[model samples]
Target: MVKRTALYVTLVAGAFVSVFPYLLVALTALKTPRQLSGTEPWEPGLPPTFANLDRVMHSGFAGYLGNTLLMTAALTAGQLVFTTFAAYAFARLRFRGRDVLFWLYVATMMVPSAVTMIPLFLIMRELHLVNTWWGLLAPYLLGTPYGIFLMRQFFRALPAGLEDAARIDGAGPLTILLRIVLPLSRPALGTLAIITVISSWNNFMWPLIITSGDDTRVVTVGIAGLKGSIGVDPNQMTAAALIALVPMVAVFVAFQRYIVRSVVLTGLK
Candidate 1:
């Protein structure tokens, strides 16, 4: 009884610790400009105001938000399609040097992506893709080794008997993979999609460097541009941050079950 009580207390403490900073930030967003003039960001600006939200919404936030959602949707779909296929090949197919190749590819993940930015930029320039959505998405559309690795792990954990049964029923490789493997991989796929959307939506540096003009700028870049020589307004900045956070929170809420399922099932293996 004591141990169970301790566990519950620990979980509650952890949740509070994790959630408090964001709660503070959200509260700050609700502050009046006069309230924000003082020191200490941790102070909960009580008796919230909606003026900051109204201000931010008028400040190109809707366009920025739309661009982020559109880009994220495209990036997530592309990543899932490519990574699912690549993961299936790695997890289930027989080929010479397959394991070695997969590991070698995954090793690249250990290398910082910052190191490759210059080369990628050059490639985009040569392809005339610079400052375009094509350039913005080029590096990520094929997905990453991490995505492949994640899906491969899930695929590997699936029952072989399922595939065997499909084969015995005269299903081809494509049919088995599409009709059987993918249907059973909802948890993993949902996790991947959510991850892809969040990562793509929050991506800042790449979009900042590669994109230009009002049409191309995403939410993260737009949020960063919210302040400048005029100095940062606590209310405005926090309000924009809160706006940026909404999509991610919604996505996590929507896919949390699948994320939990993936963790539980994958951990057991």
Candidate 2:
């Protein structure tokens, strides 16, 4: 009984440590500037107001939101398409030096993005894509070695009998993959899509360094600007930060079951 009580206590403590900061931010959004400055950072404001949220709504928040959504959706879709095709070929197709090429590609994951950021920036500049949405999306548009490796692991885990049975029924490789392999892989796909969305949505450095104007400014960068030209309004910044979290939170909540399921299945595989 004592051990069980201690375990529950530990879990509750851990949960509070993880979530309390966001709760503080959410409370700050409800406060007025005076209340935000006067009260403790995490204290819930009495008689909360929506003025900060209203102010943020009117201050180009919609534009930033739209830009973020577009970039995230485009990057995630492109990555999934390219990653899926490449992973399938790696897992199933026979070709010369296939293993060598795949391992070489996977090796790129070890190279830090910071190391390559400058060169990527120079390449974007050479192509005249700087200050453009395309530039913001360019660095990571085609997925990563990590993503390919993840999908490849999932693909390789599938039974060969499935493919062989389809082949016996006159199904081409493409048809077999599309009909059989993909349907069974929904959990992995959902998990990958969720991961891609979160990564793209939260990405800051490349977007910050590449795009300079409001035209291509993503929500992550746009919210940072709120700390400066918006008169450093803590209430507005808090509100914008809360607004920024909604989509990713919604996505994780919606797909959390699939994520857990995928994790378990992948472990078993």
Q: What TM-score, over all chains together, does every model reach? A: 0.90, 0.94
For all candidates, the clash counts are 0, 0
Q: Worst lDDT window (10 residues) for model 2?
A: 260-269
> Model 2: per-residue lDDT, tens digit, 1-269?
99999999999999999999889879999998788888998788888999988899899988999989999999999888888889899999999999999999999988988998899899999999999978888777777887788788899989999999999999998998899999988878877888788889999989999999878888999888887753687788889999999888898888888667656644665
Error of 2 at 230 (Å): 9.6
Instruction: Report clash pairs, candidate 2.
Output: none
Model 1 Cα shift for residue 168 (angstroms) = 3.5
- Off-target runs (Cα >4 Å) in candidate 1 are 1-10, 38-46, 261-268
Q: What is the C-alpha lDDT of each candidate?
A: 0.87, 0.87
lDDT of 1: 0.87
Model 1: ten consecutive residues of lowest lDDT: 260-269
